[model samples]
Target: MSEALLEGGTRCLRNVLGRFATGVVAVAAADPADGTRAGLVANSFCSVSLEPALVSFCVAHTSGSWPLMRGAGLLAISILGAQQRAAADRLAASGTDKFHGLPWISSPGGAPVLEGSLAWLECTVEAEHPAGDHTIVVARVRALDAIADGEPLLFYRGTFGGFSR
Candidate 1:
């Protein structure tokens, strides 16, 4: 209940959760009107349902890019491959152009889909719920495809790597 206990608990929770390996994804979108792009890398992406074709990802409340991307109407989730670690790092960083030199193409729905990704999904925002430090976004998939055959870029123990067969 004390401040010190709360701080320690937070740190511990993060450390504990880091043990679960997760695939990394880039959630991105382009403004249909002006061509501006916004994106962020996330390892908190997962399938939420199959009946209605839904997916979800978590975005930090502190992320400056989320607001811009959120209003873009449609979004693309690119499943990163091992070769795209640089792309992940660039998207994860703040205070700079995340797509300056990033090679990407627009999805059918006008969202930015990073090149060299293993797969991609274009979706529209279905719902958003406020979590502790992040917003849980549920998306309705409009289009999706497996782009290439490769191992996925993964995050584990606070670091990025690829899984081996």
Candidate 2:
């Protein structure tokens, strides 16, 4: 195995990467004192180390909400289902009210777990690294659950789609 070849530039690279589908999830947290919520949609969520129960996601370096979530006591990941594509789109946008119409619940640790998620995981930030234009966030899972049983929302070819077959 070798590093991905990007001979065609970023546009070509993005198009190439878009061919690989991924599930989307919302990473969020709340400051209980002031009721400030920080969240963003990410398709880069995945498990890392098993012994320590580590999970990870990559956030863009320019994400405004991530800064607020970085120091939180807990961060919750809501794996979006087929019905939550709107939430993903809203959260993925910049400088907007992401939770305006969305329903969610707070974890005992103060992270917001979106309603209707396929699965959810609550964790504490373990480490962060600068990777290209994104920040690699590694967290240790403290609590997790299989929420609603359903197909996941997928991102592929620069669009949202549902799983089939």
Per TM-score, the best of the predicted structures is 1
Q: lDDT of each prediction vs. the true structure?
A: 0.93, 0.89
Per-residue alpha-carbon lDDT of candidate 1 for residues 95-129, written as tens digits (9 for 90 to 100): 78999999998898789999999999999999999
The residue pairs in collision within model 1 are: none
TM per candidate comes to 0.94, 0.93
Give per-residue CA lDDT, model 2, range 1-165, as digits (tens): 224454567777787889999999999998767878889999899889999999999988788998888866689999999999888988888898888888999776778999999989999999998899998999999998997889999999999999989
Provide backbone clash counts, one per model.
Answer: 0, 0
Off by over 4 Å in 2: 1-7
Q: Please report how far candidate 1 places residue 105 from its true position, in Å.
A: 1.3
CA-RMSD of model 1: 2.1
